[model samples]
Target: MNNFTKIQDKLMEMGASFVGCSDVEAYLPENLKKVKYAITVGVRLSDFIIDQISDKPTYTYFHHYRAVNTLIDQITLRGQIEIQNMGYSAMAVPASQTVNDLEDRYSGVFQHKTAAVKAGLGWIGKNGLFISTKYGPRVRLGTILTDMELPIGSHVVRDGCGSCRICVDSCPAMALTGNSWFAGCDRSHIVDAQACSEYMNRNFKHIGRGSVCGICIRVCPKGFSK
Candidate 1:
């Protein structure tokens, strides 16, 4: 098998259900230049516990994203060491934190959006997030940045979301960044993040903190039941 086939087999062996590598050069933010390849992975998080956590109305529940990230880190660390043996540099970057400032984010890590796009995971939805072909937008994303010049798949610029505006209609905050967000019309139907956050907080007071309402996720016309 070729290098990609070998890596794909290895990722599967490491428990990665979705694996693809993309050229990280163009997607690399200006501040981060050492990156050459982005190996992407997605773990299935569809479970009843996520709903149970929402039902409990608390933040002390198990979020599968953490486990997914840990698995990605472990696999990437091993992959990096293997790449080093092949005379190249490799590193797995951590990407499982809420943006504190939203300004310092995406500095050096490969563009998760573009990386997913090239990897044939899915198209960019109206929410400025990647939608998985198999899992839709429910799955979380992570990337490993490395100096290893792995082959990149084709760039997916065609949009699958054509005229379907369920996400646009369901966005409570109107934070969808394309037709509404790109137009800079943030004062109208636009949801107030503070207000939206406060609403979640209010729900938390009654049920659970940081519970995912998933109205938008449910309303989305991708894969999965609303």
Candidate 2:
């Protein structure tokens, strides 16, 4: 198999639920501009656990969230090593990390959704989460930025949520703006990050140190079979 297929196959073997590549030169920050391509990975979360989430996040969900993030980090690290073995430079973006110094307190070093969307994986939801074509927002994403040219995913999926507001009305924090997300729109247009963070910190600090609230993921009907 060629390098692209080889890399993809290895990531799949490493437990990635879905994988895709995209040319993300336009989306990279100045420091990351050297790597013009991105390999995005998504891992599906437990339906049983997510379904149990109601007005508050459960301890089980909190543990599951951290476990998934750890798995993403491991898979992305392996992906990075595989790319480097093939004589290309690669950087694995952390599965879940907030760069507090950035102007956006809720932001990370890079937005995995940016690469995932560009890779034709999914569209951003009204809840401000990546809605994977196969799993909706019930998935966690990992990314590896690379300089190696690779096959890019096409057929970008459009917003599947048309007039649906379950996630919006279900947000305990009332942070969702009930606005549909379009490409190139600011995140602030759909959700208030400050409000969401503050609410979580105020009410759920005992759960996951106020870092997680999966009510939106639980109420989303896009990926539900029931």
Measured against the true structure, the TM-scores of the candidates, in listed sequence, are 0.72, 0.97
The best candidate in terms of lDDT = 2
Write candidate 2's Cα lDDT for 1-226 as tens digits: 8888898998899899999989888888899999889999999999999988889999999999999999999999998999999899999999999998988788898889999999888999999999998888999999999999988757678898899999999998899999999888998899999889999999999997998888999888887954
Cα RMSD for candidate 2?
1.0
lDDT of 1 by residue, 76-157 (tens): 7776676677677676666454555555432333446567777777776665556778766766666767777777757554
Give the C-alpha miss distance for residue 13 in model 1, angstroms: 1.7
